[model samples]
Target: MNLFRLDASILPGASTSAEIADAAEAEWAAAHPDGTVTRRHIGTGFFPSDAWTLATTAGFTPEADHSPAQREAVALGVALAEELRGADAAILAVPLYNFGVSQHFKIWTDLVIAGGGPATPLLKDTPTLLVTTLGGGYGPGTPREGWDHSTPYLERILADVWGADLTVVKRELTLAATTPGMEDLKDLAEQARTRALDAARAAGRALAGV
Candidate 1:
């Protein structure tokens, strides 16, 4: 039961999203103490974009290449992708910037997905759990729902690259008013933490087939 925890919280403490991710890891460790856990925190920042080198390696000509720095980029992406593919289960916790995932997560995602890596789709059959936190509200079916591209894009990329189905647990801070409704949102966030932990445990069990 290999567990990979991807934490993308930019803040230091009291980050609701990171908290949820931690809860998930805790549950995984409890369920499989012998299993190893790999934690990748993107909040430390990225190592620049490696799309150019990766593109070149994928058969793109030098005319299409951007810079020589791509060697660094593609190497990092390939390493990360390899790590992701070998893992049995994954947990991604990222805060939604504006209306989507931050550039940090996106960078990692791009590398892990197909066409960016040497082999493509880091993990072709492993299931991934994405726990995302947003600033405002937007559930399943609504007029503004289409504005949300996080889950849909994530699902598409994961399926295309990893051939794995992603279970997205999106936590939107649903407070329209500036004065009130924050407490309610906090409550919801706490529940999300619990849910994340439970989900991680369940994912571990499923991965272990026990």
Candidate 2:
């Protein structure tokens, strides 16, 4: 079995999303010690800003008429798509950035969609685990209720658009411990984080067909 893991957290050690993903990956490793794992760190080496535009244009152009730029873009898209296609399962660990999806993840999504051949869905019902972390609370009755825009958007693409059998694990109030004015919510944040990690581990084990 192979696992394709994409991490989109700019903060390496401080990222709650990454921490949750690690829990999942650890479970997978325990089940399949020899399984191959491919990791992509979009937060650090993000896709080119123009990658989406180039890929979109490439999709519209005929292959015979493709220019060097279009060819490059198409190649990039193909590579990204191939990575997902080859994996048995996938983990996408992303964090809300400024109330929206991380730009890096958005670009990667666009490239993957553009790269899928005419007859194939990008994910084709692959079992996918989406792990996300939010700095502030956005659940019902919270001060920031309905403020989350990233998670829904991600669901729209990963599940609705790409046809992935998706499982979502989210941790909110991640900034409670470090961000001023959120001290009162620190305990709740820790509880949420723990739950998210446990869910991740369970998801990973399930993905391993255990």
Candidate 3:
């Protein structure tokens, strides 16, 4: 079995999303001791800002007539798509930034989509686990309810667009402990974090058909 893991956290060591993803990955490692794991840390070395535009433009141009920049962009897209195509399962750890998807993840998704070509779905039916962390509560009845814009957008891209068999494990209130105004919700935040990690472990086990 092969697993491709993408981490989109700027703060790798302090990220709650990364911690949750680690739990899931540990379970997967336990199940398939010999399986290969590929990791992409997009947060640190994010895609170029204009990769999508250049790749899209290249798609319209004949391969023989492409500019050097266009060719590089297209190559990047192809490589990203190949990673997904070659994986049996994938894990994505992303955190909401400014109420939206991380720029790193968005660019990666765009490049992959552009590279997939019109007739092919690189991730068709592939099992994918998405672990996300939000700094504040956005669930129903919360003051910030409906404020989250990242999760739904990610769901659309991974499941609807790429046709992946997807499972999501989410942890909110991640800022409760450290944020000055959220001190009262620290206990609830911890509980949510625990549940999310447990769910991530279960998701990883399921990936091995266990």
The C-alpha RMSD in Å for every predicted model, in order, reads: 4.0, 1.4, 1.1
Clashes of 1: 0
Off by over 4 Å in 3: none
Provide the lDDT at 72 for model 1. Answer: 55
| Whole-structure CA lDDT of model 2 | 0.89
Give the per-residue lDDT of model 3 (tens digit) for 63-88.
99999999999999999999999989
Those runs of model 2 whose alpha carbons end farther than 4 Å from true positions after fitting are 117-119
Q: Each prediction's Cα lDDT score?
A: 0.65, 0.89, 0.91
* Tens digit per residue, CA lDDT, model 2, 111-168: 8878875446667678889999999999899888988999999998888877788999
Say which candidate scores most in lDDT: 3
Best by TM-score: 3
Sort all candidates by lDDT, best to worst.
3, 2, 1
Once model 3 is optimally superposed onto the true structure by TM-score, how far is the C-alpha of residue 67 displaced, in angstroms?
0.8
With candidate 1 superimposed using the best TM-score fit, by how many Å does residue 77's alpha carbon deviate from the native?
A: 1.9
Q: After superposition, how far is residue 8 of candidate 3 from its true place, in Å?
A: 0.6
